[model samples]
Target: AQELLTKISEKCFKKCIAKPSSSLDSSEQKCIAMCMDRYMDSWNLVSKAYSSRIQ
Candidate 1:
């Protein structure tokens, strides 16, 4: 979870935050939220597949 969160933070920061500011704007927040959700879904899917294969 830590590793995944770190990756999601980096990816969302690059993709959503166009300019560094005092804080994230509403749009940036929304974009990051959506990106994180998608990343988490993908991660979960991959993890399940890998675990199933190992078993």
Candidate 2:
């Protein structure tokens, strides 16, 4: 799970953060964080639903 999280973080951060500045800007970082969260949340929900359907 930790490794998956790191991979997701990297992909989302790369897409969202076009400019690699010294520090993550507040607003951009916030957006990236939220986007990563929602992405993972939806992924979990989807897996849950899929497993239920399969079972």
Candidate 3:
């Protein structure tokens, strides 16, 4: 979970954030939300496949 969050934050920050700021704007928030969801979905899919293969 921590890894997933970290990865999502890093990727989303790079993709969604342009300049460093004290707080995120509405659009940045939405972008980060969408990015996190997509990353989580991909992570879950890969994890499922990896577990199946290991078993």
Error of model 3, residue 36, in angstroms: 0.7
Model 2 stretches with alpha carbons more than 4 Å out: none
> Candidate 2: how many backbone clashes?
0
Question: By TM-score, how accurate is candidate 2?
Answer: 0.69
Residue lDDT tens for model 3, 4-55: 7788889999989989799989999999999889888988899999999999
5: Cα error in model 2, Å = 1.3
User: lDDT tens string, model 1, 7-55?
Assistant: 9999989989988999889999999999999988998999999999999
Candidate 1, RMSD to the unseen true structure = 1.7
Each model's lDDT: 0.93, 0.85, 0.90
Any idea what lDDT model 1 has?
0.93
- The number of the candidate with the highest TM-score is 1
Q: Pick the winner on TM-score between candidates 1 and 2.
A: 1
Candidate 3 local distance difference test against the native: 0.90
Clashing pairs in 2: none
The C-alpha TM-scores of every prediction are 0.75, 0.69, 0.73
Misplaced by over 4 Å in model 3 are none
The TM-score that candidate 3 achieves is 0.73
